[model samples]
Target: MQDGLLYKLAALDSEFEQIHRLNYETFVEEIPQHGENPERRLVDKFHGENTYIVCLDGEELAGMLAVRDKRPFSLDQKLPGLDSYLPRSRSLCELRLLCVKKERRYRKVLLGLFTKLAAYCEEKKYDLAIISANVAQGKLYRNLGFIPFGPEVGSDGARYQPMYLTPESYYGMKERTKLLSRMDGEASVSQKHMNLLPGPVDVSADTERAMAGTPVSHRTEEFNEDLARVKQILSSITGAKHTAVLMGSGTLANDAVAAQLSLTEGNGLILSNGEFGERLIDHARRWGLSFCTIEKQWGGRFSREETEKALDKNPGASWLWAVHSETSTGVLNDAGMLGEICADRGIDLCLDCISSLGTVPLDLARVYMATGVSGKGLRSYPGLSFVFYNHEIASRPDKLPRYLDLGLYAESAGTPFTLSSNLLSALKASISNFSAEERYAELRKRSDWLREKLSDAGYDIVAEKGQESPAVITIPLPERLVSRVLGMKLERSGYYINWRSVYLLERNCVQIALMGECREDSLSPLIGLLRDEMKSRHRA
Candidate 1:
């Protein structure tokens, strides 16, 4: 309903009306599972316990399925020793009454409902799910990662087979969309907006497959080994001495860096040329770290002279902080030069390398501390952030907040608190598969080509030549054109440009990111689309 499709919990009177009709059509009319009734409605016996997930296509119920965790499942009654027949599990659920309109053509109704089912199971911590699937739809069910178990039940055309779904089994089927596309002819990948944002970039199938695997205890040796391996790879790539993985975002990682900076004996010099740089000043302020800031216009390049003058003015500065890539303006500061300056001045250097880490070649060996995330150019899912440090850090249980305490995380081998093995596994797969040489070249070449295309199309690029980062390209809207208006238009057309962030809105800007697996040819159409938007604006 919202943008032609909506997946939600079935609650409304109207939604229930459609659900009952669809259930009757599926169970009675189609499957011959129920006796015909005058009302033509066949609500399930477990309707009271059922949590129905429905897909709505402009107020029309496209498809639906109900989940109920209460025991004495429909399958339990049909197949007498259900528990004995199945694998051991802590908690199980029953999924029933699945249906999509048989008379109408639906785009992704059933796919959307099944995705919701998977998410709901995760939220409820259901280890396994049981379904008495229609025998005729066995291939479709198996394609959805359901395993058939026990003997068939019911008479003739109404036969049903007991099936179960587990995370491992689901992942096995969902291992790659390539398999699905090959088997089903068309890719069953549900509706996806073209991802051109800076973070939460389109992840690879390997990363998805890794994330789909069942999680292990964070405290287990198996989990710690994965943790150590990821840390080692990160350190090796960035030339950082150590890396501490935390279950948070880039902002949280920066806060951790600020906590470390707070320990410095003298003042720190923070430079602000864009949004992320300004955030560093805020982080330092909140941490009560004594610091001086050198402010410049957004997208302005910080020269060696400007930084040297700032350090000279604050001779006693113990550390320096700045963003390696000012994501808001798409300006990439020279991390190498900054690292050298700090080395010569005997000051610790820290960088917010959140957006720059994977897009650019980094040598953080000289950097005292820096921050990165699991998403961004890594092409992994978000939620995991890293604090890379060049020195051994000890636990500081007394001074900093427990979660932001980098020392605590470092001393404990990056898992002082619970960590998500799902995110960790995905990150490992992405990093392991990443080709630094190839990816860097691709981003740089693509960034240059896109900037040229946009510029030739009569649009102003925010970052001037020699200042732009390969990761994101920020474009300011013209005086008459509203950012939100243009962004909405692009989104409805399936291109998700970054424009809704508070800072971007304040600046009246939108962005195109080259953070993930983007191609030059893939961007030509987008450039033409932008050119069309501008042409229409001019015509109007």
Candidate 2:
């Protein structure tokens, strides 16, 4: 047991009896007694197969609940009617024997245990949950959206109410309550404090109007003209002569790059420190590309020596890939240094700048190729991806398929092969309002403010001060709080944060990026909430 709580599966030995004793104490001694010999009931066959999640507060057994196959429990003759509403299929689960020690009843301990049970049911894909709610607790189940299947009846003269809860109903109630509570909490905070959380950064009115314009035929000359305009603007922003606008996501852009590079003769080097980098390697391997990697753990950054050594060892490598801003770790690698090394070695450098682009300083002059999306730092809708490559790679005519060929895009179609004129107009409008330099400066300012606020609140950042990405700020969560709990708590408090898990071999941490309309003002209330949550955890 740690932190005054014991969380574990119930054992069949003395611990199980202890839980039974607590159940008797709560139901028989404390509450109204419905069954005879409640103090010492014999262990039944049902108890043998059921799994129980037992929680103890210090030496005191605080709670115990039994979960068993729903089919048997729902269909059993001993229980009140449920077959009328529920199907006999094995798609359901039953939650039984929910008992919390008297002291822990209203303290959220039972709620926490029930929340875990709900999560477990959802994960296991159980379609429904059935419970024989007692008369006194019938309103509790009703409030939770559990409907009674049949008339209330007594089990051996012990008044019980038969209830049924579908997975959809349960989750719907859960999510609705969460959203309502979140909105209420946000409203409780001052508007000045509320605005601290990131965006609904309203898109420019002109840009929205442009996007609302009539759609153009993809094959029409007018469409090509709009496409050309978008291509020029995209290239100007990234300092690349070659840029492509695809109908798919940024993943497609990475796929295209991987497909194009894998056609080469030699091995490739993948620099992986976060989820996206590892995703790139997965894409390469899926496409059967020969590759080696220099990996850093999650929330960890690679040193210059480590990168140089990987390049030195893989002398045959003709292509190198790394993420400019690893959204997972919120760390920005030294792209310029890596680019120079790859260029000098006659290797093509590909960068995943999906979360970086307009938020950071990028020079297409240094890197050979890069992939970005319209959504994340570009602040547009997510349908399009821009692929930028240097003149050398853009001029290559070798083995790339027509669709994946950057050379073909450069020489002929420019950005769009089959374009959405409205998206093109939106891209132009988003870029026209702000220069690349202005975007970079604004991002830097916002990220700095965020870092300061988080640091003031006593959070440890994943990246070093000066080495962090201007677009993202990653913070290490306290060991006592799981990422899921942290995310749910923040969501309830009207803030959404991303958590990292891909490089689990390294560390578990949370990341907060300033890409959206997030501001420093939102941080104050969030810090207060964090402090409260920390106190609650410590108390638990």
Candidate 3:
């Protein structure tokens, strides 16, 4: 929902009643398409089979349209042999009863209805949509990608031009609508707050320009070179011999790691102290990997003794997995110590460095298979994830899924399937100038300044001084104040901070992630805004 209006299928009894009344208002009184009803409500003849998509403004129906799949549709009555007259489609549907309230016409009621209808059709696997649109609104239909199919048809004084919308037209219109909506949204966001969310960090101007450049085919030599460069840079950063880039989020990379672990014979131990570590449990379960978890309190650091205890419990454990930087709690675990423990036990160690990859100094050379993403510490657009492994993945099991199979990805030279050239190029540009030591130092400086200032302001820090990551800072909200409420207030005041996750919201915690493109000068004002907001909330 947006602009104080909701668009969805009219499923409830009250909603269906509103649809009937709206039908009467539009067809009976306004358009004269139906006979006058004493009840002031007109139900369509195919109401039993029709699925109405309605837009509501604060419980009041503002606009609606009906979709039906039954034979002898309204268009069939006007234009005989409708299928013969239009493009051949296996799964066809008819749309009718399009109407909007007079006062709400200025709003995007029609567009909302169209969007809902499009989603509904897509869900139902509809290939084509036919509409007998009012002749006066022909231009509107055309603009919506509905092509006039046959001769204008209908009874006198209420003639309609039959039109059909194919999948191609529907998708094209949807993209255009999305582009325009995004343009408007970006303008509004530029004048308001800049987002500082962890995953979708603000992209730099050069990366944006790289993303905007003309796309190349994934199989072409140019795209292959770009993909190779991204993998090489990631390999260099992590100090790994090989890296495989996947077209998904960091979760996908972790899932691939889980899948790879499933191929191994013995049990594994997963360390958990935060949300990301917990998610790895789910991934392991989905992959059907036999593993035991060494659980710790959120924001709590893991010691070598704990790792040794978990290994001692699972005597046959073959690998150890843990998150380098627990983004949820701002806990930066000792991966080096954990690696040493695994090495002593003769067990391979896998790390989830999605949040720590470029934020801190990391050495993945000794790591078996570690996950990293293009966004966050990498300072690039999301949609690309990588798994860096020291071993030859081609020697792993061959029965794994095509997308999740590290061997398949490595064998295909990192372009296992259709990779987005734009995303690869943007990531390449981001990492081309990346300096691990310099970025880590800069982030450490910023984190130190922010932590000192925040602690001085009497905030409860989630992570202790020496144990915190260089790029993430978490603070607990005062008693009786919801983190989400304060987060929204900050957002409205031209600032955006991460909060509202179940883990954070339940504990009244808010996070300030220093991942994306940002500077020291920008931090002072942001810190000021946060300080003022907390003070105001304290007063309240």
Candidate 4:
């Protein structure tokens, strides 16, 4: 079961039941380690604490293993002098219940187990691993870099050897045709922790290396060339005639848009269907602009007819503001529809497309102005923001703050103050040759797959179906389970999902945003944790 088998962390009740059955099959019927029971299920005493990574052949369990970092391992009881036998490790984890089905014959099953084990160790930062290897397969264990560290333990008929594995010894294995090294080569070494944060997300190794050298002066030609390149890539992605790379958050970009809007005379209509939409309203209000609003529930979406009606009521509304992707609620308002509506009416359109820019293909060549950030969707370091506009602006040196003045940024060649060359270099690396079309399809594919899996596993997604953003999925936790508690629990298990923030806490919601460097191997394992959580709540 090479490609047919699935190797991932054990998270669901069904998987756990199968695991227990396999435990009975391996430990009781095969090894005689435990007495047989009528239930035909042998639960490991450490089931409460052990983190199980399994190999599955469709619904059936092909093989399984578990890791527990807690002290006083089973080996400690079996061998009195276990501590002296083990080498010093910065952090240690005990691997147990490594049983492969007889049909698997140890090779493929063990290979898959070790592959999953590698990812698990990478996540938990476990440098050294210890296992009680069955003496019958001692040669295979030794081949995989397990060194016998203590005397044999267990009954003569069912003996075991205490062994340890370290990265150095594992790599030093002369035989290198194993699955662990082959399947996950560079990914395992670099991206040990899977980051699921909405923003300040993980950057690629190349992106990090782009920022490694000494910072160049912003005034220098080299730094200015990088500035021009990033701006060109952003313009290509959004189709904006001009883009200003500002040094701040997405809010700063929006603030600059507000300053631009302050010059317009007529009333504008702000759209609000989520938290970010409300923030847009705040941006308008703080700028002292007179604006009407079309407000909806946080996760609700705006239809074209409703938007048209709002514009109709606010007769002579000169501009319209809306958020393309609502990060807080995982709702994506239709920017195209809104843009079309505004275009026909001659209403200038301003958008907060921060979370949508790199995740989806956006056409904004005809739009008035929009905001984006380097970190969230672009997968770069966070210190930079961009404001994209199609129209030219008059410099408002007297009316607007220097940073908020879009005209100043454009007129001064997108550099009014000193900017971090490191940030710009990383940003350029991330966005250069921007492939928004391909990224859009991939992001949607993964989001659809993940959403279906989560839905089938008894999780309640916050955004209504067909209205949710493919880049982020907001899940409302059950009334009994606090998002903070559940989110932190997953974090301890090596998944850093989004929760604990004020907005998420207020709504009892957690988000899984597939922003940067997401892959099938990393995303699929997350479902087990989610399913496990659902099963636990039901049991309670």
Question: How do the residues 1-540 of candidate 2 rate in per-residue lDDT, one tens digit apiece?
Answer: 223554445532445678767766655555545354834643535776677777766445678777887356733665544566665545777777788876677535554455556645665677777777888788877867687876665544356677777766776766766643343233233211122211223355677887899987777777787777777777777888677777778898998888778667899899898778889989898889998998887667777788779878988998899898887667888888887788778988889988778778778866667898876776665577877876554545565666777666666654437767787777677777657776788778877877786776667788787778887766666767676677655653346666534442235565566665555654555665666655556777
| TM-score-superior candidate, 3 or 4 | 4
Which is the leading candidate under TM-score?
Answer: 4
The window of 10 residues in a row where model 4 has the poorest summed lDDT is 183-192
| Residue-level lDDT for 127 in candidate 3 | 94
Q: Global lDDT of each model?
A: 0.84, 0.69, 0.83, 0.85
Candidate 2 ranges with C-alpha deviation above 4 Å = 1-202, 392-402, 414-416, 499-508
Ranking by lDDT: 4, 1, 3, 2
Two-way lDDT contest, 2 vs 4, winner: 4
Cα lDDT of model 4 by residue, 332-447, tens digit: 88888998898899989988999998997789997899999999999999989988998788678889888787788778854889899999999988888567778888988999
Write candidate 3's Cα lDDT for 1-540 as tens digits.
657776666644566788899889888888877799689999889999987888887668999989899888887777777778887788989998999988889536777677667667877899999998899999999988999978998777788989899989977876878743553343344233456677788888899999999999999999988888877888888899999889999999998998888888899999899999999999999888898998889879988777788788899999989999999989899999998898888999999999999999989999998998988899889999989998887735556877888888878854868889999999998989998888888889988988888877677788898999978888887875678887875664445789967888878899989897666755665666566666656787
| Most lDDT-accurate candidate | 4
lDDT by residue for model 1 (1-540), tens: 223666656655567778898999888898887899999998788887888888787668888989999988888778888898799998899998888887543435665576667667776899999998888889988878889898997778888989999989875765554443332322223334578999889999999999999999999898988998998789877888888899989999999999887776989999899989999999988888898999989889889998999899999999999999999999998887888899998999999999998989989888889999999978899999999987888778788889988777866844989899999999999998667898898888888888889999889988899978988999997777789998876764457899999999998999999887767755664775687777767887
User: For candidate 2, what is the TM-score?
Assistant: 0.61
On the 0 to 100 scale, the lDDT of residue 9 in model 3 is 64
Segments of candidate 3 deviating more than 4 angstroms: 1-192, 395-398, 537-540
